[model samples]
Target: MEKSTNLSTCENVMTCPIRPIGSGNEHCPYDWLAVYDGRDEHSPLIGKFCGLGKFPFSIIGTSQYMYVEFVTSPAGPLLNTGFHFNVGNWPGHVETAGIKHGVCDWLLSSDSLKDSSASEGIFLSIAHWYPPNTSCSYHIKGHVGEIVRLYFPSFRINRIESPILKYEGDCGESLTIYDSDHADPARIIKTFCDTFSRPMEKVDFVSTSPSLYVQFDSKTGSYSGSSLYYWAHYDFFNNTRFGDPVPNTLCDEVMYAWKHPGGRLRSPLNSLIFKRTGGSDVRCQYKFVTDRRLYARAIIEVNSVSFKELPYNSNACTRCHEERVDKLVIWEERDKYQNNLACFCDNIPRAVRVISSADQMNLEMIVQGQHAITSYFKNPNPLFEATYEFAHGPLCGPITLGPSPDGELVFPYKKALAMVSGPMAPPEHHYRREKCIWELKVAAQRDLWLNLEKARFADRSCDSAKIEVYLAGRLEPRFVVCPENISLARDLPILTTAELGATGADQEPLPVLIQYTGDGQPGRNIFRLVWTELFHLPRNPDGSLAASLLQDGGCDFRCPGDTEVCIPKHLLCNGIPNCPNVTHTSTLSQLTRHIEWNLEQLGLLHHAGDYQQLVLHDESPEICLKRDLSELPYGKLSLIALGLCLMFALLFAILRRMCRSSSLHQGRHHLQEDY
Candidate 1:
């Protein structure tokens, strides 16, 4: 039968309604019905069929013209029935045609059509018939920020059986879809075989990027008692409805918690328009970040979580221990790898709330099941939806505890009581990883004392709570104590600065830092510390009050000879004499006397000798005079002084006699010149 030009606008299929009596083999059949691609016997033979089989078998032709012939041998079976067939055409069917070099490859784009209404359409694997031993690829491209959505309304492929085993082998004919325009194995979104098409259910696929690739591969050229065909529709639309796209990423997104502070986060698989056909694993991360200075923590309330074929139960999180299971994992971005807050594999009915330890939180959905079916209908896709908000809670910043002499400090600071006591109180675990710091200043001339009144922890090992005391100008803590350290707690009333060997002589205010870190179980970890200031007076090592040595009130060193000048402790025994009463001639002796007395009074005389040696040498005039006066007897010292004076007088008389003789000689020389 030949179709006219007007009637040949679509593909033609011929159906036969008779079972010929012959072997089913096509090459050597006794009785058979022959079909051709053209109007005459000279055309290519499509297939020859003969056997007792179902009637009304159909064969689709490659074009409008087709030829058919019926033949029977004289020795054919007598039970053979006569054959008759009909030829018809589908009006609007589209066939898979090669676009380049006879290769079944096509590039389809949404931008090809200017009309918005015509941006989406349908195509089929076989408008007439798919060529055998051929592979066809369709690349669908869309605009930026747009993703491709494809749906298969009808799909069927012939199942190839093993020749030796006589059972189904690997799928010889398959349809595969890639998330990107390339047929890379890693980008493959889903693959369908005869087994997957047997259910006759509609399937959906979506691309994470702006392009998608669909490939149909038929490995064998012959038919296997079934028609291999599929019908699919594709559309391109913006993906902003789900979330803002993260740059340089396909499926990942960044939810704006810093600007909006409150919003919803949904898994990409949750969308009705897009569902993952699980052949490979998929991981998409949703991130929420806030300004940590304004918000202390981000709170996430999980509305629901669904995993393919995984039932909801109390142990859902625990049951997803295997790395291959579908799960939703949550954690703070700062500690993403180290600390995962929770993992869910099933729906959460109670709306579990999780608070991040810091300002940023991340939620990742992982779909790793090789055979899991992710659809919006019968088998729900792996999905999770959560609502998040940046929270500003009390006691999140540094605090100045006191100018008061004695006061007590309690952790959970008293103000946080309101957050924990009311009917709207959050669970105790919400406060996990709480950190607080308090500063206490020790007044001048006073010592700071810290007494740990109470230290309690839920875990007796005290790993949950940590208490540290840091002294001024120190990086390392002076005291690191936990509730479990009974011996350390009993040794409290610690002298904050003195324990570090700091003398309180300098009248500067000392700052003591107390930091408390809590493990968020309410009422389980508690810390109470009382600080007291004690009047401190510098004292001598000899059990005597060193204040007796001060001429001026609280002076460390005093000038001699009633000058009333006082020097600081650092100036005492220094090389330079700073005392006002001592003169340049007597400075050394006076400074030495005063410093020696002061050092002795302060019980630091042993330390004074080292400084005195640096300032004075034994051969110096002052030292020699002092030594002579001190070592000689009183009578010998006077005789030595008198004898030295008489020697000076004899030398002066001899110098006077020499000067008189020189004057008399000059007078005689002048008299001779006059004569």
Candidate 2:
């Protein structure tokens, strides 16, 4: 009773597990004498592969490359030889797999067809094995036809021209592509069609193999092509095709076609690049999907050009606060810091919303960089310096935002709540912070000395307060905060922001000016400086400060069901597609997400405490002193309702002086008659 066995090898190859009879082989009948490498692990003879002549083969895993490919040397003396699968270890092995880090199970390229004659009739060998994390199912005993192509560095190639195809919009059915290098002004091609217009079309239908959604956006699109759910007929102009690039391989997936919704999906060897600038008045469209299954589209017609106004070194803190911005808010951050104050090589999306005034709300915005996190609420301290940590590049290094691992001088938990200043209060006001510029000595006092005065509260605001000032910014480049107060808009009150209220309540103490910039010394964040307060103006009881405000036309409030929730996806979208209630050519509701500035001058969103627990963190100083003691309630019944109405008017004047002294003591009869 002696049966079980195993063994294997490579190099003139040999294998055996158990067999002996006329061994067969076309692919496998199994039989081959013996071979197994076991050098020592205390040798239990636990390794085997023995067979003779008749044929034997079995080495199911982890054995790659070292081929022989049915050799007997054809084309005279091994011509440029091929077949080399080098991996060793086999003997009663079943199947075990795992590997997924930079993938390379086994591959060696350069295989010139082995037999131009005995020149190199390499035997057969194409080994396989993969080990790491692990996953294996094993089947498809066989069926082959392969192709794969992948390219990206975020793409930007535009030509090579012709020969690979796939794409069909006009209700056909073909998609997938590649090919690039073409940029006829491809400045993001009018910012990808003005950032996909029609208020930024929100999505009628788009499924890129989302389990088969076919295609969509018909101006108002559909899915599975369409008849009720079909109509892939999109001809911005005779189907859609552009040029260049055609050498492909590796799991292809091109699918890019768009009337809007940011386009790009073409490749079959390509030549791509297009730039035309937004809200196209005359023409623009693009498409791609190639790797042979073809579909391409393009229609350019540009020169409309609408995108400019943004420069001051692309905004180093509002061009240094608009060169000492004196014009308090005349509205013009046009759409969230006006395309972020400048520098848009191209990416479109900040449309409209300008009107800003009051010398542009105190004006802020200055930049440089470093590394600052605590989720950065206010910055500008070396902005990750060292010769500008490679300067604000789309980069990835240098980061700084100064002192807060418990050092706390400013912001350990406040979060970037921005504040622009100068509520007209002149005579004296100053501030700089990174190098010291403190001038504002303000004194208004009374919220009962503000909970017993905390260092008279400097930059956290409010103490005696109406306004209070000491302003000047971008750190005056580095130091100095109060040297230019020409009576700062004479006397006070111009914080001015009336999109209908809340920007002035008898102004005075508001002389804010906290500009930052470092390397000017003390504490650092590489190269620091990022101010961004961007406008908040008001002053005009004669002290000057009204460069632009009386325009007043666009905002009376209204805009709701017109409930239109939150607009600003570029104005509510249009070029094509619409859904649930606007998302394509934009309808713009942005009264800016339910307005409530308990503070949030546009950093996005954040709020904490103290300003008296932030107006009593949701009220309860006894419900705001019982709603301010129900506003006067007759002054808590003013002294018993005025002492019961002055004791009923002093008892009616003592009953008219005792009834006129009893009518003159009864002599009234005689006196009446005589009268």
Candidate 3:
């Protein structure tokens, strides 16, 4: 019976299935069946049935009638066994005959390494097939200085009882690799076999040369069993010498783009850039890992600096009306849009420093093409660069008390409150997230003053890294401060923070909580505060209550002319009576003049309109209220005035009776003592 066929002249290569040799009880010998391309006995062999050949083989040419012949001993009825073949589309090149995809050898180049909708890195994979006679070969080559690093995450080929112990000999149904541009057996690097003890083992290899050749051959011999196992998984990295990229992270990588030179591992500071001459989309991900308790900061120094396109006409106010050419996006997590930290593009170069809120950050850079192929080739322009590092900690100053020997505190004042830095520095390798909390206290009956002299934050705004001031026993904080207001400390004064005990109540010292966060940007994080323990000043001192209050310095604004009175700035012309007599101004001009001097003194000239309004009545609502009491009927106004007078008279009578009763009680107490 015919054993194998030759279809060398077939126009397209075909995939053929192998059939069992014979019926039950009949066993086939080793090398029982074989198939070749041409009828010429010297033509190269393609596959075989129980021999050193692979199941998936190429069939070539038409008009080349395939010949199948059995090879058996001259003694026993031609072995009474044979094989059959059927044809279909080839497995390796199905989508396109010549185009290679799905885990195949590829030529390394700048254009091929880039990720696109149609392809990825230079990767290859071989699936497990049951038939014993299955063999394949792959070839890879690249330019000079480019080395191939082959990594096999998974490898398993045929369930053989034992692997070939000899290093020089080939194993049964094994895969052979060579570090050469050709299929020269002398250049064999290693041979992998599937043994019972070590069924699967990851394999990694780096080619010393620029080319690599690999071939997988199956030779079942006489061991024809129903069950079989065969598979291999691998990928390649070029332009690098390191082998086996598995179980290793690239946290120390400084450059993520394809073309630019990367930074050294231990470098303290480094910059990353994105540039492309081929006008293709580029995508890369990087993870920042650190050991210290700190945060990270990334500053965009230059973005697309080489691109020189300007507005088309002079009428255009800005020259930034072009298409987006590049983007640098940062994420708190690996997934997109979940915790997107920020997105930097060409326009609106906010020059903002990005702070990582978490211990690790994921960054992705995508360089989009803005022009056509011809445009890019003639004038290729795309550039992006940024620098990143760990930020600094806050500055902790001293806390001094009022006239009480600088930093020392006596009894009742067990705890003294002052401004303290965020926390200690992070380790050398990497920085982590950190938080600090402080408790403040002051003397009894005295008020606590906290002044934030200087403040700097990880971000442009202090939202990510902020200080929360809360009163003791309060579920919510009384004040939440951010760095945006304090980013540039110009002439603006640090608003004074004061806490006083309730009137006539003997209570413990006040307690305030300040929580500081060092979220990544420690180099930029800074805060300085000064706290002073003030003495309790007399509110009504010798009929000079206002003057005493002014001396205490608690008031933000002090009324002129009547040097004896002081009032808060907000209470100025808000339909309230805080200042003494002759305060009513009939015209806007008169009102402005009356408060102009005091307003200027308090640096509140900007708020002149707040108190500049013409009114017919002695007292009117704030200038913004716009309600005129004179518009009301005269009788109605008279009635309202009369009601107010009657209410006051009733209140006075009640107060007089209470005073008389108190005096009578005191007299009785004194008489009892005398008796």
Candidate 4:
């Protein structure tokens, strides 16, 4: 098929001499080629082209397997004519996975324009022709946990010779992007048509999911060439959530530009000072929405927020009055004038209540900075810090997870147990500054057991500033623990244990609420909790294995060295010393020696930090500790003498061993002959 190799031009390097071939010629009337995405014929179909069209066409393929099938109508008559045309530069490489930099790895330094596909990096570009009344869709799936980012350097749709191309409504040609596989209209992240005036605004479209889909459509419009000059420069990055913050919308502006309509301004914007610029007023608006059923009672907590003073730009807020300027307003609804829930100016508010009945909330921070003629663009200092979350109930406070006290919780028993936020305790400093709550419900068959590894708090200060664990249907707490008291204990203390009856026992599932109250200390309160569901094993009268409860608790095999700790059956003979001294047999010693010997041979006798680094396969280690004897402070003669001594020693040993073996063999042979 006829195809354009160059990304910029459509003219071929070699053109047909403008002479028509004879009718009797057996050459194919149509010029066509099928290009695949991968290296070989088995690769996915990228596109199919016909005639001398699709010039300046851009197609990406893999390095080794990208195959091209050229089709001819009559098979082989024009073969004798030896007609050839120069195609443009080879198609660039496309990366489906792996790390990528800005530079294209497909371009070799020696052969700059070689026709080859790229086998490395995670960057891809797409520039294709959209035939009339036709639609082409592309689905790019990145490695697991990765998000795709597409950058459009140049975008044009339905370009003609007369009027300049510009973004117009209902354009005949359009390009749509989706964050997911299904291309529903509501799910359209961004739609492009015509063109942008401001250098295209460097629009970066990011996929919230690991997969991104792009569709190019043309509605039988008149155009000189292809409807779109859609060259996309894109890469894949690991996905992150709100807690991590770095990879979230607030941190990476381009990656999260499509979070709201028309993109968010100064995203990841938190605690930055605001100064008046020119004649425009400075106001920052942030709107957050939560699922109505999922987050019914939500609140935003802002601590230690105050508009005080700055060094040089102190005069920036000259126009803002202390009583009514540079303030933050919280709104329960979109109508800010009437639905303002709370406003804070020059002082921090404890907590701003978000409207529970609705699914959306708006936050607006205004800084009426005084216009300074000389100091115009000074960076603002941090204004405040806030966090939003849903509370279980009004009694448990806004920081607690789960519903209110009256809300029913049902947890089912499972074979495996897991913790949501991990078993490790949060930072002690944060515990003192904030109050946190957690609620857990165990299934009816669960026999829940709670253990505290460590707890530390104020020493005998007040009982009110402590942790309290409450069980459902009970007014008194099952356990009132002081972190300081627990810290003084020698061994871990079992906090509580609740056992539910068997099925159809008319028993309610266990519901537990854990709350930690701060003692107004910066770094004095901390605790860790680990809960396990115990299974009652039916042991025989002789105290042997229980047929029914075998492996119920996941630890079935007893350690040979120490029966005190039962290990998982899978851990037995898994190369790890699970049985302590009993498992540390000659096999362990031999494995250790082998590793050490390999390390010595590589001259990298440094202790192995990661076991994978110690394992030697086809790839050799880069670092070694071995030193060359020639580099030492010795003459050439000395080095030669040392080498000669070693050579003689080795030769003598080999001769002695060979002679002894030969003698033994001769003796045996002679005996056999005598017999």
Candidate 5:
């Protein structure tokens, strides 16, 4: 037989029964078949074979024509089974019509394939056996704003078995894909090898950019049973629905919480089939931020989740021992510890809501162990879908109540409590432990009074409720009250800032914190309290009132003639005169009467006689002056008196000297007559 082709192969020879041949080159002396590079007998002989065993394997010729001849000895045994052989042209390189650059590089473009209307096509490797030490690359291009997707219909390649002696090279065959036109290591999307004993499943690939590069490489030739080949289809289309990509990242994206307050979030290319790259797990973080002030927290509701299932002895959501299973981790990005609020894996049955404690939150999708050929095909679409929204939290107050000296503070703030009261409210168990705080403040140097007007509970026992009052900058509560101690609390005096030691320049705006901890059941647990700003009275170390120049019992210091105006202690002795008629005694009797009245109201009438005597006898200026001087310590009054006497004597001496100078300046005659 003669054939014209670049390459030819002769294989599948059947066993032949013939006279036994000797050995070596002369083994097939009788009934032998010969293969030649040319059609005629004079052509170069490639190989000659014939024997009792099926020994002549496959023969390949790389010439334009291949010739084979078969002959048998006339005296061969009658029981001999004639030899059989098959010859044909080997499979050639892939069609070169689409090649654009290099010998085996092909370029496919959506614009060029516009006539097909679908903008899609398929290509294949050699039909049968592939050439040894060969490489082929395919470049897929799309227009701006368009993305390319590639799918494999059929794939089979020879897997190189480990040899006893190691060598330097890659696998016997491999298929690599890049996200971009260039085959940079960092841009590689995935790589596939025929390492599994069974057949590989179908797979899909997507390009983040407009172009995708695919390369198939073979390090060794294929034998009879193994055909190193594949069939792939590609399409180009617009993908406008993909979220805005994050800068300096491969597949991450940012969802602005402000612009899209409530919307859906999905894994990258949610609608397409994709496999995680080999070697490492694929992680994509969707960050939610901005407009944190508009909401107290973020809520994410997972609609569906699909991932590769992993075997475990315990619950996978709490603890995942398997490294190969995929996971959807939800957390608050603002949390320094990165505590995961919820972790979901495998298949989730019902929708679950994850509420973040902070304003900003993150959802991370992790795809693991998809690099293996079997896994690549089996787990093509491992992804999750969720909806998110910014929402107000259920907790109440860090609220500040101030400027107005007195106001009522109610626990379980009406508005916040209403939010958790309806049919859609959270389960009752969520209110097992709840806390609410309110801060009360007053002007500088003023004391605050707190009185509990009402304390009621649904259970009536109040075992789950307690109220605490704390001074500013103090951790310990000044007073704690509960239903069990209600009688004692009622008997106790009203709580005051002065009594709690929260009075001074440093403690201005005297802040008092009222905190309530309870089950937080709406309307079931409630309380109301009132606060009042009071004047701070100064006391002496002996438990009596401090010595005041004007001993008006009610007022710390009262103006002499103004019964209606009460002067604060700070105003006394200050350079600016705030009181009228400071030297008058007309209002002394009225002031004393007022003092006596205030003392009676304060339940201190036992000291009324002493206060009456102090105001009545000290009304005269001379007596007032003596009493003021007597009040000074460390001999201050004596020093003042001595300094005043010296000042008067010095002034008199200066005046006398000036008069004598004036007389000397007069006419000399008049001065002599005077002398």
Candidate 6:
């Protein structure tokens, strides 16, 4: 099928006859290759990709999820089934669920891609799982060719491109990204001499079919339960560590296919395990056996497909149902009727009440994480929300995600659970006044449960879980998770500061969240706190505690661990947006320009702080600026002009209509009806 796309051009290396990223052919792509290998998993191949093995298979495109092929030799007795391909720092590694696949494990043979053949590519192992797993095989028909290699950008990352292509041929066809739409993948490929300096924005994928189109009808989130999949590994005393022990480390790769998608096909009478490996584009070649359309009905089949598990982390997280109330109020709450709640003002006018009943604030939380975090399956919309109501009437929503033209002023953050906070004595002394500055790690995004040994998928399949919480901290123990409070109580507390003094406090990681997976593997993630010490713990009148850095109009409130001295201005309102006060002037200081007139017109200038804040909050004013409308860019001037004209026209018409109606009614009533 002929297809094309409008791809944005970016820089890449010089083209060498234009190789696809993993094209197995010639055509340079925009992104450069970072790593390539054909080594056994027992020893991971980690090095800079200067270019090796010709890659033999050019990876032209990728889907949200793809399969890895492993075929058996004629000498093999096991059936074929599912496969795995761990790429880079992602869910990276290959595992087995079928019968033993040793030296003859791969289907891509040495001679598969020799320059002499018409197929013109190497023969690789058939990746499908069979026998011990299940009988499923890929049957390549027509001018069959296979392309095997990782992609720079996985199809899932480019979800925007999905609808742009569809099946045009009468047969349900698929489209493969031949190149960067405008450029080649391989030719632009650059060789990174250093491994530590590799660019991380790109993605990778592998394929077995040489066809541009490999059908991916349904896709699921990547596997999580498997530490073998997380791209991180640990050294453990026992083989079965990380939370719970796994019964059978692996499963057989067997599946039963009752119906085929193409109407022209018959169900398999018995299990079908194609001899996938022995190299050379190893998928079975179908000549229709006798040239029937049923053989043509075959689509790519996946075997030994394993999944991960999910955890509620109810132990570590506090929500409405399970309140960890009264322990600690890390986040603050305010009534919509009173904008002065976060402010120290004694009396706010009732006419311009800060708290209003007109808005619903689902945003009722704030948290501090221990380390890098990940978000699994959180089925909530407006996933992140923050509201700042100025003494003025305007409320600014949290910064919207996507391309930020003004650049990201507030730090981007991720959410998860980690090990640092359980059953431990608080630190003795806060840090001495270094700088008035304190920065928290809101940019990295996730937390982790590290040093796991065995992973068993429980509640796998389409189910994933997250850890969201309320303002309260709990005294009760967390559920099933091995946090500092739980995991350490076992063998952790025994280890001391002397033992780990050089190792930065020996903090154990905790599980924050888990994404979707199958019954065999489960996922866990967490959040991190870079630094958050500005808010002082104040002694409330009732012997309770409140977050404060100001006392009696001074900034002498006591600070927390490793935070001895903090500038009072830095400890404002829950320590977000780095604004000391929740008002109009403070918010505007973060912007480039201002227009204070708009606030005055709205009767909302009470919180302008000073004249400076007034200007920042309103870039569009009630009166005209010095610049001429015609001289300024049309796009900018037209918008403001249109808004003003519309406002004025609306007011005039309302007043005019009222006067005429009133006059007519007065005349009729005064005259009295003759009848």
Which prediction has the highest lDDT against the true structure? 1
Residue 627 error, candidate 2, Å:
37
Positional deviation of residue 183's Cα in model 5 after best superposition, in angstroms: 13
Worst 10 residues of 1 by lDDT: 1-10
lDDT of 6 at 669: 87
What is the overall TM-score of model 4 with all chains considered together? 0.30
Tens digit of lDDT per residue, candidate 3, span 456-504? 5657765566666666545466666676655323222212223433334
lDDT of 4 by residue, 346-394 (tens): 5543543333224455556665556321222322434556666542222
Error of 2 at 258 (Å): 35
Clashes of each: 0, 210, 29, 16, 0, 128
Overall lDDT per candidate, in order of appearance: 0.59, 0.22, 0.42, 0.43, 0.58, 0.23
Error of 5 at 584 (Å): 63
lDDT of 5 by residue, 1-675 (tens): 221111112242243323332222455645566666577778766555554544323545544477777676656534445555566777544333243675457888887666556535777764432345657788898888778888778876654432212234555566788999867788997777655333344656778778999887666643222234567788775544334677765457776755666788776653232333544566778777645334455668898987644454233554643344578888775436677777887668778876565567888876654442344343335367888765542444335677353467777566665567878776877654555555576655555556666777666455687788876555567888887776555433434445556546556644566667676667777777655444444567885445462244324343343223333443333333333332244555654545554444334456566666444221334333444454457587689999999999999999999999897778676878899
What lDDT is obtained when candidate 1 is compared to the true structure?
A: 0.59
Q: Is candidate 3 or candidate 5 better by lDDT?
A: 5
Rank ordering of all candidates by TM-score, starting from the highest: 5, 1, 4, 3, 2, 6
Q: Write the per-residue lDDT of candidate 6 for residues 1-675, one digit (tens) a residue.
A: 111111114244233233221211132122222222333333322211111123322221112233332322333312212222234332222332112234223222213323234322222222211111111111111122323332332111112111212222221211222212112344222222111224322333222233221111111111121001012111101111111212331101111112211122111111111111112111111111111111111111111111111253334322422343111111112353322112111112221111212221111221112110122111112111112221101011121222110112111112101111123422324211110001111111111111212222222322322111111122221222223232222211111122212223233211121111111110232222112213223457885544462343323222111212222322222222121122323233334222233234333345344444332211223212321232358786799899999999999999999999999999998789754
All candidates' TM-scores?
Answer: 0.33, 0.18, 0.29, 0.30, 0.33, 0.14
Off by over 4 Å in 2: 1-474, 477-512, 515-654, 657-675
lDDT of 1 by residue, 1-675 (tens): 211101111233233333332323443346667677789999877765555544333456666788887676655444445455666875434632223324457877776533435645566774444445667788888788777888878766655431111234566667888999889899988787755455334655778788999887765443222235677877776655345667765468766654565777676533433335345566677777766444566677888886655453223345564555778888764433647778888667668766566667888877653433443322333367778766543443435667554567776556666666577876655654555556676655545556666666777665677888877656577888886684566445435335434455565455576766656445677766766554333459985546654443335544443223343444333333333322433545554555565555445566566556333321234433443454468897799999999999999999999999999999999999999
